[model samples]
Target chain A: MSDKSITRRDFLVKTAQGASLAVTGGLLWAYLVRQEAKAQPYALRPPGALAEMDFNAACIKCGQCVNACPPDILKLAPAGANLPIGTPYFEPRTGACIMCPDIPCLIACPTGALAPELKDINKARMGLAVIDIENCLSWKGLRCEVCHRDCPLKGKAITLETDPRGLSKHAVFRPMVNSDYCTGCGICEKACPTEVAAIRILPPALVQGKIGDHYRLGWTFDTEITQDFKPSEQAPPAPETSGGKPAGMDYLNDGGGL
Target chain B: MNTPADLSHSKLVSRPLGARLWSWRYVVLRRLSQFGILLLFFGTAHWAWEWPAKTPLLTGNLSASELFGRIPMADPFAVLQIFLSGHVLQQKVILGAAIVLGFYLLVGGRVFCAWACPVNMVTDLAGWLRARLPIPAMFVVSRNIRYFVLAASLVLSALTGLAAFEWVSPVGMMHREIIFGLGAGAMALTAIFLFDLLILKNGWCGHLCPLGGFWSLVGRTALVRVRFDKTTCTHCGECARVCPEPQVLNLKRLEETGFVTSGECSNCGRCSPLCPEGSLAFDLRPLIRKHGAEGSISSVRRTK
Candidate 1:
């Protein structure tokens, strides 16, 4: 039979062992969770997906959305994929979201990871399509504007700007992405003919920049400049001349202004 | 005085092949249940197998799924953790979880662990190999450790604002990966297999899995249970040896309760068919008490 009695030393040692194991195990688990949570930025979610933080917390990683997708573009990130494990993501180069009119994937989400508030597929900003100007055929003075032509919202999301060549009649029809309407469905990226896609979709947070509220374009038609700086209409009374010196000259002569 | 070795060799040599196979009926049934669930999920996802109504037969995996594109079914433990993490789930998934929870509450909670969990197959294989391979245990830990793990998972979910265990669960990883596609998730299963086979016996399921721990707690009031007949028992030690959780077979407790009372009994049906004297069998919890009373009266009459 084992000894039933415990010495004070034994009790202390046992308590310390249990505490240490719990602490060590807890810390290791927390570290793993932190690492997994940090991996969400690289993944592109389905249409109507919640913001990165909310989506991470909300997604049950069920792949119901993946199943509901008609084009079969979405995949649950498997372990060691470097994306949050089991969360649905898609690769645009291989298969991009077709932007299904019915929004089956959004309806399929059980956990509200894909927000139900999104009624229209056109509003989905899955990512922003960024152009590598140097590698782009259109930017190289060719007539290639496949992204502009193939965009679901062709005229609104992707618009062509004609730049005339110097000393020649040839003009480059450069494709520009308008953030207001671009859904980031990645059809443009898929349609890019370059060996490596010149136009690629990226999470908007990675590529989009904000001009803070401090700076406003006054020339714009509807500039919301709250208060414009103005000089006082009436100038304050001039300082009294000291020893017949010019106003504001006494400080200069006294070497106080420096 | 009869050990597991004597019972196995003596009993098996005399039995015909049909009788031998009959002994393994529950084991075979468990395998069928495990594989059949996986096949359904796989076929629906990949092959576009659908009902006559054109609804996919099953969508999603074990974490959550829908049957025939209408009835939702979800993992209750996972849903609970998500709720604890402060997510208000959609009605569809919450309903799904309720349906599954209600079913398990009636049958037995760990029935999910034995009948549905894919990880059980891998660990069962490890256990079978370990029993025959002469691998000594590396160390021993309290089985109660799983309860602590389960509590910790809940606390962690509340603290982290994420379904803490689901993020790292090997059970979820294995099931989701198999139905969808394979990935480094297999590594988790391999680690568990080696851990069960070499480091300890039934290490993952019995000692560490919080999901199993959750189900064990839920299984306490389950209707189905293993009924024990004390008069017929030979105490041959066959059932305990094969049992994943042998402590549940404590004869003194069984005698008093007239049934396995522990929530930890997974209703895996391993011990019932293997009982040499036909002492143990599955019965309804309500019927067990009546059977126990009748058994005592019959024994008293025999003595007189």
Candidate 2:
């Protein structure tokens, strides 16, 4: 501690030092939490919470939503406990969001952390429910419609899709989630009768897979509109890997059969 | 060898527990307010009667509350973070924050730190224990650091798109963890206590907490302030001894301006009761001139 008064230079230096230190610390913190941000670890946010990035910014960690929840399902993440401290999350395995008619939690959120416009709880996209085909009893040739039965949106969100293979003696009812209708309420996940629940709600970030933009689906382009849609009379080129089209394809014969 | 101020202070300290408790009236009130608020939260969370499991009276947590589904109470700092982070400020949140801000404007802002914040009780306990223990002052922290801390948190919130400090705020941590049994946040609370007890006395609240700093800004224009009656004063210096922010009660500053104008004052009334000459009093007056803001200004009130 210096006895001399702080010169203008001293103040400037300290400010610069402090600012730099803080910036570095903040960036480091954001980076450390980036992985956690990507995967919410089955932590279900209250209805209408913006996507993970926006919600983190918007939520003040007020815990008002937790109080508003009648089922006592909502709980704020403890400091240094996963999913960013003070942000509310629920484990579906414990107790799922009941999709209350009035949606009390959204009304309770002071910050638009929970989207105020989301008056309909059915529209909540907390996560996407995906049925594990390998572990699902219905997929294993057993009659298990537990998930499909308990879905809040029922017919719209979770519907039975029959197997095209037609190997079963009886009808195969495989529960499939329609992403458009599934609110990711986790009701189906909660209701699954399997030892390890077959249907699980996964955060949107994890479940939504992307295909490379370069790999265009050829059929998507209208054949009527494309100038290059000339029906070729000549033989097709040899395959690049195999050097020639031998057993698999004789383009002329295939075209004639089609 | 002790001065007359020390003699009176020692006498006050030496008095029986009952007499001393009566003497410190405001302290008792503040403690009761802090502890009472905490108990309400604890009871609502953990101890409601099952049979009479009617709607709980107080249902909210530390960051915000709604009483009887009508009254909306919020922590101004927490709400402000949301706004600063580019969140749409809903009408209810705005009104709730305004109500809190308005209350602080009347009573003085640092009143929250003294009367409501559970963390203050912990730090105050640490301060009390430090007084009795033979602890040596380890270092000095400039109180201006709080303003910097406030600035940094605001910047971080804007940049990171989060209520940045709420992630680690010991105040929120203690409130939540105290009820939930401090699973992971125990270390943070323990560190704060130890920091106050051993390192810099009043380190966290006095020098570091951005929330306290924010309230101090709100406290600047507050109507209630400490007024020094210079005419009746002996230069006993007892007011400075117990004062949390001793710089607020600087003799030269008081002589120049009759009121302690720094919003940093918690209005804890620790100085007033400790004053041997009864020169210090909490008064309601217009803050025409804040001595801390403009240096060496003459007293606005009539000088004795």
DockQ by candidate, in order: 0.66, 0.41
* TM-score (0 to 1) of chain B for each candidate: 0.93, 0.84
Could you give candidate 1's per-residue lDDT for residues A1-258 as a string of tens digits? 246566767889999998898878887887788789877686899999888877988899888888888999999999988898889999998899999988999998988999999999999989999999999999888889999999999999999988877226688889998999989899999999999999999999999899998888876757765346455799987779777655666668787657
| RMSD, every candidate, angstroms | 5.5, 6.5
- Clash counts for the predictions, in order: 0, 1
Task: In candidate 2, list every pair of residues with a backbone clash.
Answer: A57-B161
Q: Which stretches of candidate 2 lie over 4 Å from their true place?
A: A1-42, A163-171, A210-258, B1-17, B42-59, B179-181, B286-304
- Residue A216 of model 1: what lDDT? 84
lDDT of 2 by residue, A25-133 (tens): 7677555544434444556798999877788767766676776688878888776666666678887867888899899889878767898889788888999998899
Please tell me the TM-score of chain B in candidate 1 relative to the true structure's chain B: 0.93
Report the Cα lDDT for residue B116, model 1: 90
Best by TM-score: 1
TM-score of chain A, model number 1: 0.82
The total of clashing pairs for model 1 equals 0
